[model samples]
Target: MIRHLVLFKLNEGVSRDEERVRAGVRAFQALEGEIPELSFWECAWNITDRPIAYDFAVNSAVADTDALKRYLEHPAHQAAAAQWREFATWVIADYEF
Candidate 1:
């Protein structure tokens, strides 16, 4: 399986508690059932108080690279990412496990 992980840090003036951010987070959370290639999907707000911690995260798994590609290219994923781009910056990693 391919484990795809992403961490998002809100932009300089963005707040996690704000309505817009929460809505964007919910948009991503809703993708679990929308994308057929995803074998596992989890999205959450960061609870840690550390300065280095990201504001939000997504941990997902897919059958293989092809499935991972499908997940990334899915319309729902693209839309959610475009929305998130407005208020955050993110980093991602993918690996076989």
Candidate 2:
């Protein structure tokens, strides 16, 4: 399987309480059942206030690289990402387990 990880930092002026941010969080949290390639999925807000901490995170797993590609290209995933692009920036990592 492949582990797909993403950490997101909200833009300087953005707040989690905003309607758009809340919707973005919900959109991502719903991906597990929405995407067939996702064998596992979990996402949440950060609980700590650390300088280096990201504001949100997604931890998910897929069967393999091809599955990972499909997840990335999926319509729901794309729409969520596009929305986030307006208010956040993120980094991703993928590896085999």
Candidate 3:
């Protein structure tokens, strides 16, 4: 099994408040059913006061590395990724179980 975790920090000047954060969260959560290799998915809005913390986040579990790769290259994922540029900075990850 492979657990693919990703944390996202929004671009500077972007709001990290409840409403904006929730919209980003929903955008990722909606991809769950659309991507077949996505075994499970979760999203969260960071509420910490730390100076350098991520705002949007995702944690997904896949059957294996191949499934994870498929998920990354899937068309549904590509479409979802297109909606991220406005608010997201970059993704941080861990691919090992």
lDDT of 1 at 64: 97
User: Residue-wise lDDT of candidate 3 within 1-97, one digit each (tens)?
Assistant: 7888777877777776647555666667788888888888877777786887777678888898889889989877776666666667766574666
Best by TM-score: 2
**Per-residue accuracy of model 2 over 1-97 as CA lDDT, tens digit each:** 9999999999999999999999999899878799999999999999999999999999999999999999999999999898899899999999999
The estimated TM-scores of all candidates read: 0.96, 0.98, 0.81
Please give the TM-score that candidate 3 achieves against the real structure.
Answer: 0.81
Q: Give lDDT per model, in order.
A: 0.94, 0.95, 0.75
The lowest-lDDT stretch of 10 consecutive residues in candidate 1 is 14-23
Candidate 3 collision pairs: none
lDDT of candidate model 2 versus the reference: 0.95
What stretches of model 1 exceed 4 Å from their correct place?
A: none
lDDT of 1 at 3: 97
Off by over 4 Å in 2: none
Q: Which lDDT value does model 2 have at 12? A: 99
lDDT top scorer: 2
Per-residue CA lDDT of model 1 for 10-44, tens digit only, reads 99999888898988988998998999999999999
